[model samples]
Target: MEDGKLTVRAVERALDIMLCFTGATELTLTEIASRVDLHKSTVHRLLASLEGKGFIMRDAATDKYRLGYRLWELSANLSKEGDPGIILLPEMERLRDQLGETISLYVQDGLLRVRIQAVQSNQAIRRVAPVGARMPLYVGASSKVLVAFAEPALHEKLLASADWPTGLDQQAFLQQLSDTKLAGFATSVEEREPGAAAVSAPVLDRGGRLVAALAVSGPANRLTLEVMQEQAPLIMEAARRMGTMLR
Candidate 1:
């Protein structure tokens, strides 16, 4: 092959590795080699290059590869060109009214979650998270919801790579993610921001891909654990409604 053709083929093979993660979350070297019909050595070389560029990440705990935060960032940028907040605003408003708390929409951006839109509470004392504010994905209810639905490989990668918050060890944190996924929602009290409480649910697109997290947050005193649990269904319902609209 010509030098130019060789370079193009190399790029295509790298993209193949990325494309493998579309419907799946993680893959081992052997699995990737088999799927792509390449030798394990070739796949390993490609994976190394992709990892170097932040297009992929390895979970030390599992020895599996997953799509990295960079990929999420690029995908987010594409989705932001046509914002979901416009379509979700009405539902967010309804949730805020129902709970008398603030409703915010969040999307994963690299290792952080960014608030894209929010409807503040009517009460005098409330948590006000400004749009565009970023928070660690390992902490808040909204962030946790995003992490819960994310690829298991991502969970492993985060545990192995990131500095977890105080009082949350790796196993406990993984269990929290597991529980969140099983319950279809997440709740946090002073996890990310002090004296703030929140309950969040996943918002998925028609294809069942996680599009964002819908959350209701307020002062911790007003939104206790029981209160958050009680309000979980409402937040979940609102997220479902938004997902339907997104579809």
Candidate 2:
């Protein structure tokens, strides 16, 4: 037990040192030690250990340390492993450019839909949602499509449970889900934001599993009901293309 505790502590310290390299292009031994709250010698030993394993590298010219290519390669592979964001960004950009509206990609993380990618429209008037922001599945168009196409059991669980109360009754929201399914996509005018309207479509993987959602949003006045109906097919097509790429 004591040995396990000691090993855990060592691992924690090592992780702290590794995390300190982020947001820094390069860091010297003293900088790393100060940020990681370890003595210089201890930090150096840990750095040497990590470098030996190809997780970090030291620059001969500046004597600074940076994350190694091995780390970069691993991160790249892991980011694309089950994530649809990487494969969808190119299409998202294309859609944004075509419609002159903001485009976003999101995936369900527990009860929240987390945005993983966004492209700002070039127009002077635009809608913007930052990457990594979380929104409830019950309110936004991007979130609702995922919930609409979700498995029946999971959909019932989400609807029956009293978790997210975005100032709407669950029964009414369930009716909205039915509507979304009928339309083959989800759309909202000022549901998430006061003056923004959006249309969203689901991205299904090769296994026909719901992987993510792609949404295009803009000013409500411009995105009328007729306009949304017209644009819905385009958004769905873009998502379908992304799904093919992911497969």
Per-model lDDT: 0.87, 0.84
Model 1 clash pairs are: none
TM-score, cand. 2 vs. native: 0.68
Most accurate candidate by lDDT: 1
Q: Candidate 2 lDDT, tens digit per residue, 1-247?
A: 9999988988898888887764477999999998988899998988998989898899999999998888777866674665567767888899988888899988887777888889998888888677777777778887789888887776777766578665688778888888887887998999878999999999888788888888989999998878989999998898888888886
How many residue pairs clash in each candidate at the backbone level? 0, 0
Give Cα distance to truth, residue 33, candidate 1, Å: 47
Q: Determine the C-alpha RMSD for candidate 1 after optimal superposition of all C-alphas.
A: 12.9
Question: Candidate 1 residues 93-127, lDDT tens each?
Answer: 88888889999999998778888899999999988
* Least accurate 10 contiguous residues by lDDT in model 1: 73-82
Query: Judged by lDDT against the true structure, how good is candidate 2?
Result: 0.84
Summing lDDT over every window of 10 consecutive residues in candidate 2, give the lowest-scoring window.
Answer: 75-84
True-vs-predicted CA distance for residue 76, candidate 1, Å: 19
| Model 2 alpha-carbon miss at residue 39, Å | 28
